[model samples]
Target: MSVGKLPVIDLTPMRAGDEFHKRALGDALREACVHTGFFYVAGHGVPQALIDRVFAASKAFFDQPMADKRKVDKALSAANRGYEFLGGQTLEPGAPPDLKEGFYIGEELAEDDPRVLAGAFNMGPNQWPAGVPDFAPVMMEYYGALLELSREIMAALALSLELPEDYFEAFCTEPLATLRLLHYPPQPAQPLPGEKGCGAHTDFGGVTILLLDDKPGLQVWDALNERWLDAQPIPGTFVVNLGDMIARWTNDRYRSTLHRVINTSGAERYSVPFFYSGAPQHEVRCLPGCLGEGEQPKYAPVTVEGHLREMYRRTYV
Candidate 1:
């Protein structure tokens, strides 16, 4: 079956017991990954109510006055959690700061946890805003749901690569995951030439699952056509995309396409993107069968922690 610029995949067959259906779904996923590295997922089984609650919580938190939101400034957290005001992040060096404010959350770890005790980067407790009483609970619930969904999707991706469905299981224990809530305020009618809600860049982790409101701001770079294509929002679906780590693992067979947000709709936009990665100590080497005869691996093996730390340093100003 021919797919459009972006395909919408139903994940129901992945949960079915029949091997035939599962393989078919895997084949579809492989096609999408090789071609675009981006797709919309439906029938993912995440409760709509949970999604709504998370969005409501995000709105409530971002709606607070600037002074109130600044109390949990991300600059104060060693783990990069908490609120990041506008101009705090610059995805592309030398570019203007992204015109968005965000709140970052990660798995909560106690001060004495082994990872925390070892001073592992990005493995620590998150800073929650005092103003939004329900934000922490709602976001934590949503994060757990997305993490489960990511596991299922990872299994499908493994099958697509002709690997065992559980091939990634070992690497996922104590994974490094983050849920980012972003708010882009309305832009002027005629803005500066280079101003954008977000600069063009690819994600640094294994995969990103994004929940977007009804808006037309996201755009994906069409490398083949040398044009930008709108990744318009579709109700009840999450926009799933491959990240740099996955592309490296696949030996460049799969793309980690560049994407950016520009809120030209003149309205506020909110999105939640969950980034999932393997355990920090796991080294990402080119996968078996990803290379053919005489094909060379394009990247050297790197530990998840090292790569992520470098990326965070470059992007988070």
Candidate 2:
């Protein structure tokens, strides 16, 4: 029961059609959520070839000159797409800017889409880099695939919470998902005081599926022990963690722990983290079984879009 290290959960059982395996997997997921809120997931059906292709495209895109990458600056995109250079944002309030660069992509909506017409935030076209010819295509493919995987995982999570498997379907019809490709350059031997690759903060969405390179830099704060534990990368698997929205939905039964990255690996570190959340218009309320007898709800109902907009305002420069 010691939640010292992140747990590894095989997702194959949940994906399989066996009811027994599904129930078992749900049980394990429930425990992991309550204890650690983070885990390593294997057997997640995404093809390794597809993952590799995306990584390759990410590197190629980041390898471009600063001017080339800046052509699609996120500041120019109303939908929060495009590239963000190092120090453009700070995840942890009052901390120095993050020492990393990243490209953000989301579901590409056309100008005529109803959501776009309504001026919905985060519901418009993504800005593709002209320098990397194959970056857009490869990233789009990965996004479409991961979106489906996220739904499947959500179903499993619903079951773990003692709700019907399809309980979350309504909230996902127009998911506000984001696929971020991040590159952390080799850190200086003596970094400025208070500088970090990514500052300590909890994700603002529902779940994060992270694929990291072998070089170690990510660390999770162990609140139980008041210490930082390395989230070492594992081959052929991804690190999955719950986000603040999920913690709120479950009335704090699950954790949304603080985590950060420090790239002192003496090598450039690349990571792809897909952040999946509910539809912008969906209202997140406390689930039925989350509150114990006579326990008051810890949070008020909030719309996904409103929460995201506020979080973005705080983080972006």
Put down candidate 1 lDDT per residue, 22-107, tens digits, no spaces: 89888999999998899999999999999889889999998999999989998888888999998777776667888999999999
lDDT of 2 by residue, 1-317 (tens): 12246888888876675978888888989998998799898889999999989988999999999999999999899888999998877887778889999999999999899999999878789999887778888999999988988898898898788788899998879798999999999877888787899999999999999999889898888887888889888898999999989999899999998989999789999999999987988998899899899999898888998877777777663
TM-score, each model?
0.96, 0.96
Q: By lDDT, who's the top model here?
A: 1
Lowest summed lDDT over 10 consecutive residues: which window, candidate 2?
1-10
- Report the lDDT of model 1 for residue 311: 74
Q: Which 10 consecutive residues of model 1 have the lowest summed lDDT?
A: 1-10
| RMSD in Å for all candidates | 2.3, 2.1
Candidate 2 local distance difference test against the native: 0.88
> How many Å off is the CA of 217 in candidate 2?
0.8
Provide the lDDT at 254 for model 2: 94
